[model samples]
Target: MIQLQSSAMQDTQLVSNMMYFYSNSARSSNGRQSWILLLPDLITQSRQQTRVAVLATSMLLLAIQSREERIFVESLGYYCQALISIRRQLPLVTDPQNPDFLPLTCVAIVLSFFEALCGTLFNGYYQHVQGAVVLLQIQGPRNCALVPYHSLFYAVRNHAICASLMTGKISPLAGEPWLTIPFSLSKKSSSDLVNDILLAMPRYLSALNADETASETSRMSREDIVQDLMNHLQNLAGIWSQISQHEHPIAESTQPTIPQSVELTQRYTYDNPYHAKVIANYRTAHLLAFSLLSIILPCHDWDVAPFLDDSASILSAAGYLEECDIGCAYFQMVFPLRLVAQHSPCATRRRVAIDMLKRWCGEKPVRGLANSALEAIYRGQCVIPQSPVYRNVYPDMSTEHSKACCERPVPKPFSYTAKGQWIKLDGMDTYITGDTKAQRAVLWVYDIFGFSSQILRGADILAHSSKEPILVIIPDWFRGSTAELSWVPPVTEEQQQKLGTFIQTKASAAIVVPHVRTFAKCVKAVYPRIQRLGIFGFCWGGKLVSLACQGDALFDVAAQTSPARVDPEEAKHVTVPMALLVSGDEDAGLVARYAENIRAETHVEMFPSQIHGWMSARGDLNRLVVWNEYQRGYQVIVQFFDKYL
Candidate 1:
């Protein structure tokens, strides 16, 4: 390690290393406007504090590059000295005319990156950028149009937006003065244009994410905020379309085939990864805006197809960049890829994005920072209700208070064991309980969260009816392929993708319906003493129960709770009495249609406050309200079965 001296600053080896780091790791491929290009000159001309800060940043990068404990320890020493120097100089460098202003601001930006590299200092990055934001404001936006100042301003603006995104707070630089004044003299780049639009978003997000403590009159109407988000989505789409039109006109002539898998498709050829990088950024921005829209505006029944299409496009672009093998370009795609992993509803796309990010963690320069971001993703912090916009923002007391009131728990409770005995019903493992000699029998169908103890307990409760005991059998229809509890809330990208795949492949109507019918036949064959038969289903099982009830000879009556795919056309074929118990998550309009069309004696009850799967495996037994609802749902099922079966 080189000793800290003025001579060390001019050492050929040190200078070469610093230059390489800046060129490859610090700056994007578009280096013309990047602040990093000014570092070489600043190192020679800046004051002691500025010089030390730059050196500390270089040393940290070197330590990371070499993975040397000694180098890292040495870097820490310089970093502390640099911090002290900055604090000493900060009070005096307030004026833009002060010789140290530009260099100090640059040093602050460097420290922001330094904090990001440490990763342990989660708030340190934002704090440093916040100081720089203040310095930039003091410098005035007009003066920022000059040579080095222009570059520094851009750096500050970018860092500020990133900090704001992670914190879910409005960027101090989000106002119109900063947006228009800085770009008045110099024309903005295509990337700058995109960010300029994004800079306008934090204010809206902050408002939309306001806690319940926030005064109702103080907040903007949700409808108005939604309108703004819609406009932003459209504007971002337009910018991306323009970029496509300008960069790949010939390829853009035809509509590109939407990707259905993780495989990279050569839909549009890029001369360089930078073009793909820009496209991915724009697409992610649009997708994030749409995701927010979907969460806040639940009634719109927004077609998830376009949202998925954009996700696929993002993956395609990222996959293309990975093939290009340009390390710097890969960093450019980091934000976009993270967005896909956090926001994309498609399981395949989310899994692919996560895998790519994991691969990049070892190869990227900002490995610590990347790892920290991945930690947040794995923790399922990014997909919480109004997330991805809120990204890694930790909730404060107010935020937590608001969340507790409205939000459903992630990974809703699943009991590990069931009370009933497991017995084979003609070769199929079934949860059998209650009186075997009873006249009535119920074939219980579980949801995608197959055979959880909650559902089994509900079955137990239904079976042990004191006045009229009935035989209950819950066959293992999923055959151990039940949706994993980890994917309940589907927080992480991989989990989301896994859940999606499980639904389509394992739990789909086409695959599960035949097994259900077969299970019903097997149950009847095994329990020949039963005079009448009934079927009860929960969530995905409810959908299958509905399908099975369509002129099926096996069941005398049917009931479902939190049912899926409630088509009215299928209701007309229901040959027996049917009960529909649903949560707020289901489409009431569709449920209404089923009731209107059903020929059988129909019982429709809506638990509007409860989440879907409340009566099944996803219910949180810990919550008193949810537990009450869970008990009531089973009681309803019992009464309906008693009356008809």
Candidate 2:
């Protein structure tokens, strides 16, 4: 210590901390260090990009430990440098035969880990994993049996599966080749087996989800999906039963002292952390299978009540694993613990699971991201209460009834090269057009069919207004989870239910309005020239726009076209000038009631001939009438914003 250089000391501490945290995790030991623990060796021997990624990962770990903004900044700097270097070198490593292929793969995995730990955008983590998945596919699974390649594949596979879960897409690794090939040379571990089963969940869930909205010609029969899911359910249930038969005697001497706030249940403690993990995983999978069954069939025969009993057991095992000598084992339990907290029927058990998560988050920096994601899901699930118009006037309208009542036109593909380009605003991909230097701006929130050709054209028109050219921005509010065209016409009963669910969950006003405000604030801050901001929405977005315009809103003025869930009572609190272009399909009485309550310079025009989504997602602009109406709608908005903003 007498001659210790501060920089050297810091680097040493960073590596030491990373090793301590990762190596201590209950991982499948293959007579070698885990890929994460190989960082120190990788730093010395790897290429510049791989070396930079390892350094970035270590710096981020230190940043997490110290909670220092400067260290975090340093980590980000290294991360971007690594990313640029990797992209430049990627083409050279396209051949798996190249010596740099393994290093390139390693770089991608490291970058993915960094994003997962602390990415600002939701898609950052798994999006990087997707890139790595492509690379792994190019390399082929058979080559992954090699020493360093095996370790990298073993590490990236979990993230690949997690990415699939996050995106609702089937993982490439879900194929039989991937599942069997890597382990062809060696036996699969307990965790590997558990992961193999877990991998099927996303594929099956994705199939079922797609089938619900698919046309009869394309859709799988519900019976076939159910039968396949039932097979997996049986397998998981069998695994759970077999694991339950084994007795794991707890060695109190080896058990670390768990904090008093977190109490472990008396459901068989284990000396082996791997055993505890296996039990927890299988139980979680079994519970998930049951949940899937209920969603698939929703009949009393597939009730999840019987599986509800396992919630307590799952948490008990998770708690035990978290308190074990290998403290980082809890990282593996993040998904299972979250599932328990989310789906567990027992209130007290859910509380315990949440409490444990909170404690873990406080102690470990990585838990923050996992917890944040879980919290976002919780927020998304909260359905904003619908207005009386939707609740009483004409509730539970079938898809056919809705289309008929609204004069909904079948959406057709139209080719229009957008005049404006896409750029990120507030970490969201946004469509920006018109005068970038304008002092006034309009924030356009599109209908449920996100970023449709019609919506983009509308934004371009608003931006390029002949007399009043101003900036028009349309943020990708849905992040690609837009309502499918199939769901709109909803030929099948399942599609109808899916549409309702999408409205209640994905496009919920509670979830979107806050983001709208944030984006508005960001726009203002980023463009200091923007002295005033106006917001407008169509269909689903109209409801959010309406909500965003109330109570000392960020927007100077607001406009809505065929707003869903129109509320007269909430309109009474409007603090800005508002305009409504009511569609023929909408309840005129409700619009009048809302307009009457608005305490602002308000304009209400009735588009009696047009459908609900005419100016945005549903309009057939090729037709003369639809084209005329669409142009007029944009003109009205430009005129309104010109007056107010």
Highest-TM-score candidate: 1
Instruction: lDDT for model 1, please.
Output: 0.70
- Top-scoring candidate (lDDT): 2
Estimate the TM-score of every prediction.
Answer: 0.58, 0.56
Model 2 spans with C-alpha error above 4 angstroms: 1-13, 29-33, 211-219, 245-268, 302-306, 324-331, 358-362, 381-645
The lDDT per prediction is 0.70, 0.70
> Worst 10-residue stretch by lDDT in candidate 1?
396-405
In the range 1-645, model 2's lDDT, one tens digit per residue, is 123268657656666676776666636435545776666666667787787787787788777766777888999998888888987887666788887777677677777767656765556677678778888888899988777788778777877765665445678898889999888889876567767877877766655556466666345666876787688777766666656654353434545333344444434555456667677777766776667666665444544344555675677676676666353454456666666665555545555777777766666644544655355334322111111211222321221113332225457768889999889888888889999889989898888788889988888888888366589998888886887887656555466557666766777778888988988899998999998899998877877887888789678899998777677777898879889998788777777888889888989888888887889878988889879988888888888888888
Q: What value does the lDDT take at residue 604 in candidate 1?
A: 91
